[model samples]
Target chain A: MKRKYFQRKFDIRTYECDFKGQLHPLALFNFMQELASTHADRLGFSVQKLMQQKMTWVLSRLHLKINKPLRWGETLTGRTWPSGRVGKYALRDFQFFNQTGETTAVGTSSWMVIDLEKRQPLKLDQLFTSDVSLKKRALADDFPALPEIDNSENQCKFAVRFSDLDLNRHVNPVSYIAWALESLPEPVLFRHYPMEVEVSYRKEVFLGDQVICKLQQIQGTESLSYIHKLFLEKNGQEIARLRTLWK
Target chain B: MKRKYFQRKFDIRTYECDFKGQLHPLALFNFMQELASTHADRLGFSVQKLMQQKMTWVLSRLHLKINKPLRWGETLTGRTWPSGRVGKYALRDFQFFNQTGETTAVGTSSWMVIDLEKRQPLKLDQLFTSDVSLKKRALADDFPALPEIDNSENQCKFAVRFSDLDLNRHVNPVSYIAWALESLPEPVLFRHYPMEVEVSYRKEVFLGDQVICKLQQIQGTESLSYIHKLFLEKNGQEIARLRTLWK
Candidate 1:
């Protein structure tokens, strides 16, 4: 039988909030990631252990649906478990709730095991075993193909610094999201609640690597929804595409 | 009689470490700040409550001496209490210790309660009532005036983004430190450990405001050290002046 999901609890801090006194999406993602890593460590598959073997986990995509608002000083519990592998991707799911057991949000992510030396993907089928049965259900209705905007505007250039590097010694995903969001104007930032987020991490960004974020804003089929496409300036490489729905 | 010191414990996370696997100076400072804030809140002078009165705590200067290396999963307890007031500055002190009761580092800070609406400082004499009796102990040996470098090199410009804004809607000190450190070359970053840090915050920066970081390398009488100055690009208004001693 599969073991119970790993759970961790924390109270949000003041600095984690934005101008509106609301919890930031970046902070939410970080809480889930911390729980995931801690859970993996208990299972003897921690990031540090993986790094020693020259294998690291790289996130490919994440989908989150927020059902409630999280604010400062609220005690919340984050629970996560490895659902199963979807083809070449290792899948994991997360759920957050308040003290009253009310669900706040749910998230699902896909990660790939990368051999650091070879810089290539490693198959998970033969590499590991788990007691939890892989859930066949997809996280979202569909993972849509982001729009291809030929013409775009370069928002800004971000230089990866020491604080941006994670245990794996590369630019972390939260930093990528922050850089992409910086490309938008202030009005777009404060206007809406992010209903859904999609990310496809293309390549590993390292220290001293210069990354220029280019953004192309498009209208979503639903009224008032906005879509932003992020790309690398030098090679025209697509980093990650994001979409947000307003209330 | 004085109240006992407020203490909080936390395990350093992997992301909070730098490339060398040691805890980042920024992260260490943040931990202390968190402890101070929580203490203030327990004393009924929390940032939120102060903001409601059109006042907020502003960090003026901080001096910390690192005697230990904090790594991922290492639990450290932060203890803080009111030391005393030096003229217009209310003094607070912090000391960190490991699980074995070994002292890791000590920190002292000066803070000002600012009238956010009037953009002025208010005397702390009548503002706060803490059970902890103020002990007359200077945080540092000498709070020296930063070098007035007539001619310095402008390193780079950092535009204040949403990520830089804290709960008070101002550019946080951590962001300021990051910008200042960015002025230094990589060789300086990895070669030495930061022994002493002194900062003088001059003016407030907001979102969309682009600040320029300037650096001037100087030889210290004791050993090796560096000084960095930051300012506004357009007005040339000073933001912060920093000094770091290396071992």
Candidate 2:
């Protein structure tokens, strides 16, 4: 059934590159949004129509690992599917492949239905049913585990700038990777691919707040599977912790 | 100095919007990148030279505020400046204004100088230092403060998808706002003339982890804000938190 959903291809544009001349992580999210929205449309549901009904789907969580870096003008394909559904929540997966079909990155997302009018959560039965199936095979087995952190000795600091906020009036999660990765030397970061990352949010960061990010390398094989923790700290207080894996 | 850094205005493009047809926050970051890079060239320091010298300026942190939603095909002036320098870091500022000089968004970023080859931090003395007196004076002073989050109750959760990750190999911050805002009813989000937001990064979100975002109304004001926390429960333990503010 997953095969029913069409695979989409995209080309990275020049504008998407950072000073280092690589595709920005946020841009990839934009592409995935397009792919998911298009896939939903193909499955007989339109995000627009959902909005009209005061019903929206929110992404609840995500886990990703990148094996190599992608550059500008590179052609890539984002293969996505609705792997399964649990009650009102739906499980979707995506695989990013280079032109040669080698997997560059793999990810999964869980979405839930919301009632926009009441601004409240809605049951899956209230929105979608078992019939809304897109019988695609799961992307892969052996999904990496979430990174482990001590939660102690985590002291990463950052200042929330005006540009870090998004239209929803919050800091975007993808920006966190940039900040965390930025802490590393550019040469190591540029040469190494992000093997895996698991990010969990605890608090919201506001403008002018000095944000603190803390990290600890847990365990890994060939750096492709190392664990790390991230969080924001203010005046020695813990805000959030992100456990991540990198290759 | 701000006046000197301000160049001719550039119009916002339609391609910048996400599925919700609103300007993606990261688009603004990209604009800032373009404006700053161009401004850097004007200041006689091209990205190429910076790279060659093994000295690169990384965006250590950022905070952003959006006062109004920008629509498709809207023309706005993007003004940027090197507000000041602190040791090996330079503080850059950006403002988006409409034709009437009405500010739409204001942003600030802290950048650090790194030795790309040695993969080490560079001291301010090792890099060029000129009194940014002219640029500092040219910067606008009356920028708005970052938006605040009102409550933590009634939060929404989202999962970062594969597309959410960019070439930078992590979730893009702008995608977080796009996803969070898209979760809202379209009519309410699109109709308002003036919308304000402030976002900070606490942790990095990757594909497959669940992110919980909470939105609440500010008291005695028409304004609203949200707290986004991205996390996953394996053995029933919390992972990460991402917070955001929107009005």
Candidate 3:
């Protein structure tokens, strides 16, 4: 029997909306941070306490899906649990609920514990001796698949802007999503919601450089999937390739 | 001599940071949106066009700031200019710059040609005008005086979680500046700074808020001339208040 880990709840604020008055995709990422931090706190590990121990949690990969739009002023609850441990990695699952107890969105994230001094990955087993019991739930099997990179025709370009960066002084992964999505028209982009997303960063983007974002769409009968590529450009020199999957 | 309407230059991404690696201040605001949009198009009459039609912009006002920080990826420039004319409301000032001269934030705002909308004590003439060749410069002032509120200590209780409600489904206005200056210990709250700020709302904020921020001391004495506030909360509240002056 799998042990059940503690669940945490968080409220929604108005400051998380876009021009359309709905929560922006990037804002959802921040909510995930809060949910995860709260869960850690209940489990004898908090971000603040970890920092005191010179340790941090770095997000290696994230796959998310938004089934419904969250509106402003609506009180929403976010619940999270750790699924399992794999070598040096930990898989966590999240579910967002509305005031009515209906699920609005679901997310799964892969994280690595790191030693603050060495910045090296640490194993989950080394951190916790017993399994943090979370309600036994099946892992999401509907995550979007990774995109295939074809060095041909699908070309997208973007300039790395200061706003695209984050506290790590590195280009925020979300900015890549914005760039990739912005390539589409406003009407189409706004009308069709993001049901699933998968992104992989090939290299880091730096300051004062122009970036190129490329995309290719794979059409399906009922849904569609896209592959995105991001590159740093200076006089046509390629810097990096970022591949993303969106449906 | 050329007249200056508004003068402020800041690195693009630097404007968006806190202690953590999240987008520090809320990104969607009417003022910031207008600045971004106008900056992208570079059209002198966009604001005028909107006003001439007697259609004004109204936002729900959602401002939130976070303790998570933003990193540096590329060079960003933020600029504000005047979008000329709307009947008695002549000079509409806007600020927006891009990561690489491309607008990332943009919007269209409404200024009352007549104060009839709010039924407040002020009138249109007391606000603005369109004598383009006049010697009056809008940018002359570095910081506008804080609007004198009824400053009752009883009315000024330290904002707690419940009071942090997003009445408009967005973060409350009172909390905007508070979060931006969170990094400063209580000793710095009362200190004065030479800073200029203008925040126009696009949405609202709601409960269970957590804000974290810091102070960026510019040139001059460190005796209190620089202050900032960021509402970096999880539930939905995020706002930013920035102040800078010669110490």
lDDT, each prediction: 0.76, 0.58, 0.48
Badly placed stretches (over 4 Å) of model 3 are A1-15, A116-119, A133-145, A151-173, A185-187, A201-210, A234-247, B1-17, B20-54, B58-247
Chain B, candidate 1: TM-score: 0.92
Error of 1 at B186 (Å): 0.9
Model 2 CA deviation exceeding 4 Å by range: A1-7, A18-20, A41-55, A115-121, A141-148, A151-154, A159-168, A183-191, A201-211, A224-241, B1-21, B24-247
The residue-by-residue lDDT of candidate 2 on B1-247, one tens digit each, is: 3345655465554335543456766677667766766677677665556867666555554556777777655777888777876666677788889878898888776666667667566876556666542345233333233344445445444545444554344566566555455444434444442244344443445655566554544455455544443334333233322334544
Tens digits of per-residue lDDT for model 3 on A1-247?
4324444444333344554456666667666665676567667677556777778676666767787878655767777788776678677887887889888888776677789778688877878798774534323643244655564445545545444555455566566666665554444454565666655544556655667766666655466566666666665443333332334
lDDT of 1 by residue, A1-247 (tens): 4364788787776666677778877778878778778888877788888988989888887777777778877988988888777677878888888999998888888888889889888988867864454464325433456556555654677777767877677788878877866776677776765655666677777786777776665553654444556555667676766665545
Whole-model alpha-carbon lDDT for candidate 2:
0.58
Collision pairs in model 1: none
Q: What is the lDDT of residue A87 in candidate 2?
A: 62
Better of 1 and 3 by TM-score: 1
Give one digit per residue, the lDDT tens place, for model 1 in B62-169. 777888878877999888987877666877888889999998888888889999989889977777654364574425544667787656755877888887888787
DockQ of each: 0.57, 0.05, 0.08
CA deviation > 4 Å runs, candidate 1: A1-4, A129-144, A150-154, A217-224, B1-4, B128-132, B136-142, B150-154, B220-223
Report the C-alpha displacement of residue B101, candidate 2, in angstroms.
25
Residue-wise C-alpha lDDT for candidate 2, range A1-247, written one tens digit per residue:
4344557777665457643566656566656666776777667665566877777666655666566768865889988877777666677788899999899877776677667667566886655554555655444433334445554333434555344554334555555655565444344455554555554444445554666555555544444332234444545544444444443
